[model samples]
Target chain A: DAGITQSPRHKVTETGTPVTLRCHQTENHRYMYWYRQDPGHGLRLIHYSYGVKDTDKGEVSDGYSVSRSKTEDFLLTLESATSSQTSVYFCAISELNTEAFFGQGTRLTVV
Target chain B: QQQVKQSPQSLIVQKGGIPIINCAYENTAFDYFPWYQQFPGKGPALLIAIRPDVSEKKEGRFTISFNKSAKQFSLHIMDSQPGDSATYFCAATHAGKSTFGDGTTLTVKP
Candidate 1:
């Protein structure tokens, strides 16, 4: 197992509230990714960071923001949560373009 | 547009039977193809991977068959076991970015 961990394993928030999911890695990998998994959508990348302070948007980046201040920490923030945004979030770490190691996942629900 | 497409959303087989999962991609730039396996309540884990330069790669009971000209790849599980029942995902990567297939659920009856 990779040294990746996602905080707040389960969370529930009201619509319009703010939510932030944290992904921490101890492996000191170069790349980190945030993804959301839905029933039919599978896993869609929300954002990813190649290095500290270097971030990029992915397939479903709308309404979500991410920041990577250090090599080990990547943060995903939802400025304003919505019911449609409810999904299981996963964080991945990779040393290069090869295989990625995923976290356990965070199950978030917005009501 | 989905770059990778996986078929037979679900599959069932008896123990010891081989199960194959197919995936297709339209992007010719994709050079890395990998398969992931996920059990309920867990994140997807790397099962095996293959590159376009290779026709096939085998690891343990898992094999990745790639057809670069057809822009397709498939996963073959030999001597499938009941414990092998899980969701399988095929992914393609080019220029360091990757796209994942929806996933195929495999059920192996003992």
Candidate 2:
């Protein structure tokens, strides 16, 4: 909520086109994460960055990629947008042991 | 295998009643457990959390029951109100990596 914001809060894109969702934070936390939310599936992690240039894949990493060139910003990109990739995406920031602060989320639609 | 398990995809409760959501984890390595509350068109927010050393933690009308031996935990909402209606998720983490439960949709009727 605080210090966390996601851009393109709502978006509609055509299939096969690339799209990027931006996560910006002022907290300067060490960890940033990207998660996708869907009906009946709750939230699924796509990727997370432990620090600038340090990233790892999550349970649902397929078709999604992330880059955290700066500590305060993390971006989730769809290599090639597909209808299956349409969902609400969340961005989170956190330190080693503290709670994660999540962004409001970006609702994406691909047709 | 799904590491975190939650039950009752959805629940409906009346005001003043208690809504209990259960979660079980397969990884004994998980040391930090937390529950999150999310409203419509919003990001999930942290509600209450518990460490493995403690058996229970209470804050306001929310309580987290931790059974370290059983590797199971639950969230109990006392004096449930209509405003408490939201999607609740249970999560556990180790080394800053987290796994989340499927989530429970609780609708507290007035």
The C-alpha TM-scores of every prediction are 0.98, 0.98
Q: Weakest 10 consecutive residues, lDDT, candidate 1 chain A?
A: A92-101
Q: Can you tell me which runs of candidate 1 are displaced by over 4 Å?
A: none
User: By DockQ, who's the top model here?
Assistant: 1
Query: Which candidate number maximizes lDDT?
Result: 1
Cα lDDT, all candidates: 0.93, 0.92
Residue pairs clashing, model 2: none
What digit string (tens of lDDT, one per residue) describes model 1 on residues B18-108? 9999999999988789899999999999999998999999999999999998999999999999999999999998766789999999999
Residue-wise lDDT of candidate 2 within A5-96, one digit each (tens)?
89989999999999999999998799999999999887888999999999999999999999999999899999999999989999988887
Is model 1 an incorrect, acceptable, medium or high docking prediction? medium
